[model samples]
Target: MKRLPPLPALHTFLVTAQCCNFTRAAEQLHITQGAVSRQIAGLEDHLGYELFIRLARGLELTAEGREWLPKIQQVFDLIGDSVEQIGAKRETLQLKAPSCVMRWLLPRLMQWQRERPDAPVKLTASLQHGVDFQREQFDAAVIYGTAPHDLPAALHMFDEQLTPVCSPMLLKGAPGLNAPADLQQHLLLHPTHDDQDWALWLKAADLRLSNIGSGQHFETLDQAMSMASHGTGVAIGDWSLIGDDLNAGRLVTPFDLKVKTGLGYYVVAPDRPEPSAKLRELMVWLVEQAHTR
Candidate 1:
């Protein structure tokens, strides 16, 4: 077996390469600038090649150093990810979901906490619609898609029922939205840049508007729904996600029609022969809540 370079020197090199300055790297490592210089020198001598090109302002990586940075980064990332997975809290179930599901998921999570205080759940709301169990530490995730074929185990939460929603004030105002064709007079709010949600609903409704592509776009459905609640514009919202807003009269569906996009929200878990009892209980509870709500 070949002898490896010192771990400390490799770490120092990684930090220095990232910072591109010995002083900054030393400050981060809480070591003297001289020590940082010595470590880099030792590492270069061991490798028999210059890793950095000293510059007037700071430092620049040589061709060799640039190539080595990503490999060294991957090595540290693997070590960190492994340590985190092994040392993670076992009792608390880490759950991830997209921001759009917060309206529906948050209430149920609180209810779950109240009902079963012994089984704790930690939630992480992100813009991402999917999770990678191999790379992430989450125990399970709520993903929005047509199907959960990629997951080892998944439970259907609810189908995505899309319809136009807006504040009650908009309905009572002039340029009234009484029918699908009336949409031409009002501003449209889209959850995505492509306006796919609105397009899908429109296609289902068998209504074509000249300004289908024209609208204010948002990165997430949550943003578009929030704007709609404030009477900014008519936003295409998911029926399952906007139930609370509708009940509270914060937002209202102008038309009685709803279109199912074939896509749905599902609670997915990593590949495992047998999942924990708590995980199964939680997934079942989520499905129940979706049905009841």
Candidate 2:
């Protein structure tokens, strides 16, 4: 069997490789830059090869470092997975999802808990597109996108459709938006970096407006939906995220038209040799809920 470098040194090396700078890696790891440098040097000495090339500008990974980074990450992830499996006696299941999904799912999860009172759940709401299930403690995640690769198990929840929505207040004002073309006169709240939803929906509706991109920008779908709920402006909403809000009258679809983007919500579980039965039950419940709605 091949000997391995010290765990601390290997961790420091991985952080340094990720940030490509000792100072940034140290800051993230909550250690001093000098300590980071020392660990990297120790790791390189143990391995008998320089992992990083120190330049005046900053640290850059050597060819060997670049090749080893993913392998090291995988090792740490595997260690975390093993620890989680060993400590699986605890009944709580850690689940992660985007904030928008959390907003929609949290209220509904009461039913999940009620149905299976013995199976407790822990919800972690994050904006991250995908959770590193092996490295992170999340037993499963509800991710919004095309089917993510490398998961041991995945269930398609629902297809996503982009539809324009806003508070009822937007409909009462002068020059009110009665038609899709009238959207040109109001603000278009963007959920992400681009106005792809608005552009796609408009093209699908056959309404050409150059100024459709003009509007408020937010980093997450939840933020955009909130702004629209409060009558700030019209925003395109993901059907999977804003279905409850739409039904509750918090938001109203200004147009009946919807454009399917092919991307959808998926429940994903980590690639484990023996998958947890509890997580499988939760995944099944999620799919059932998606279908019933």
Candidate 3:
């Protein structure tokens, strides 16, 4: 390792050089004038050079001291930059959720941010099918499944309830929906995923849909729900994911029956000795949101 003067001595040298007066430098540094003088003397001795000239009125920097000022100032600037970058990284948070749940959770998350003001959550809209949480740097994630693996802890947020929903306008127009069997008269939207939500609901109601495969198919439940809300067709949706639309009158469950799907939403977090304070607060808030829903 390279030998260098003590850090405190370097600080004192920089302060004394800037003021060119020991008494003023000590006052600025919140130290006794004698202590400032000692530190400067020690630094000069370590460097094997005379750094100042004692004058009748005050003091003046020598040739070497003037040349060293800029270099020392650069060092302080670098240190300050490094500290700020580290602080910013610590404050940031990363989170992941499926696209469908993201739409429903985002508004509630905004409310949480407004209430807390200090804790912020960064959301990543992702599907769980191909994700590897263990390889990623997410602070937490929301997953839909019966059980999630490779997590320190998984908190079940809510179970999915599948119900047939469509725009009120659809009910007012041609082939209006009145019962599960009446669904054959109108278009049926299907999600690309093989959740078989429609088939499950049909089985619960003791009914069958032979043309279920013919209707327009969407990549996500969000897309199918969007089509349903526009009166295009009927789509099976989880009540948890469409609560806002239900309350806002954009979509309505025509039937009273709700089929309980085995899958559920869970908050998955890494295992550790103790959870972060922010993460703990978020988990609690998520549970509350699910309960109220």
Tell me, by lDDT, which candidate is best. Answer: 1
List TM-score per model, in order.
0.67, 0.66, 0.67
- The C-alpha stretches of model 2 lying farther than 4 A from their native spots are 1-90
lDDT of each: 0.86, 0.80, 0.79
What tens digits encode model 3's per-residue C-alpha lDDT throughout 27-132?
9987678767766775787688978988999888889988899999899888679656653764755778876686578888879878965677777777553235
Q: Enumerate residue pairs that collide in model 2.
A: none
The 10-residue segment with the lowest total lDDT in model 1: 82-91
Over all chains combined, what TM-score does candidate 1 have?
Answer: 0.67
For every candidate, C-alpha RMSD to the true structure in Å: 15.9, 14.8, 24.6
For residue 145, model 1's alpha carbon misses the true position, in angstroms, by: 0.7
Pairs that collide, model 3: 152-271
Clashes per prediction?
0, 0, 1
Most TM-score-accurate candidate:
1
